[model samples]
Target: MKVGLYFGTFNPIHTGHLIIANHMAEYSGLDQIWMVVTPHNPLKKKSTLLEDHHRLQMVFLATEDYPKLKPSDVEFRLPQPNYTVNTLAHLQEKFPTHEFSLIMGEDNLNSLHKWKNYDVLLQNHHIYVYPRISTDKLNPEFENHPKIHMIDAPVVEISSTFIRNGVKEGKNVQPLLPHKVWQYIEHNLFYKK
Candidate 1:
């Protein structure tokens, strides 16, 4: 089975995420799109993040209706300050029968050169790129790279940050989140800081 690893903190999984993941699952020729909930990033403010399990549960609620979309806690067990290459390697090892590819935005593609062991990543798996609204052009090196597949997916402008801020301000962000996910956040008073 082919899977597209859609990694995100999903601080709270919102609709924009679903739009992109659903697009990949339906159009990217991948059988499944795993929404990999990332552990706390050492570089980011840890206080702003929900607990790993909370974030993972929100992802589960968000993706429950989509058969091809799955919520993954694969990174939650890895050491902190994780790298994509490490997660990919671990997933590969644990699911030897599954061929995994990355589902990333075009803007991320522009900075792929900076990721740890990215050359090794390119050599081992295909990257499914979805469009992002960004001023930066995709790096010239990967423009024609066989390992990079530009998927003509929608440019979803909604972001988890936007949803969080909106919720904090008492804005009705319910429409921005999946129903169950929004209910969970509302019930828990998450992001209402």
Candidate 2:
């Protein structure tokens, strides 16, 4: 089986995420899109992140209805400050039968060279990059990578940061998330200030 690893903090999984994953599954050769819930992304700030377990649960709840979409806690057992290349190496070892690809945004691709062992990543795996708002300025080096492909993933300006801020301000986020996910957030009072 071919799988696309869509790694993120998922502070609270929302509809925008589901749409993208569904689109990837439907339009690409990938059979599944695993939501790799990272405990702490090495490149991102940790202070604003919710608890890893909580984030994972939200992802699970949001994606439970989609067979092609799965929520993975693979990084939980791995060492903290999770790095994509390390996770990919571990996953390939554990599931040798499956082919894995990286699903990322153009923003990440632009700075990917700075990531740990990025050359190894470029050589060993396929990358499915989605266009982001300001990726015209990508570093020239990225264009030469062997396994890079771009897909026109739908653009939704809403972000986890925006949703978190909405909750902090006691605003309704019903439109930002799916019905079940929004209910879960409300029931748990997530992001309440």
Per-residue C-alpha lDDT of model 2 across residues 41-158, encoded as one tens digit per residue:
5567767788888898889889889999999999998887667888999999999999999998889898898999989998899998887788368788878566887888897567
Give me the runs in candidate 2 sitting further than 4 Å from their true place.
41-46
Q: Model 2: clashing residue pairs?
A: none
Q: Cα RMSD (Å) between model 1 and the true structure?
A: 1.2
Model 1 over residues 20-104: C-alpha lDDT tens digits?
A: 9999999989999999998877678777699889999999988888999999999878987888999999989999999999989
Candidate lDDT values, in order = 0.92, 0.87
Best candidate, lDDT-wise? 1
Residue 20 of model 1 has an lDDT of 95
Q: What is the lDDT of candidate 1?
A: 0.92
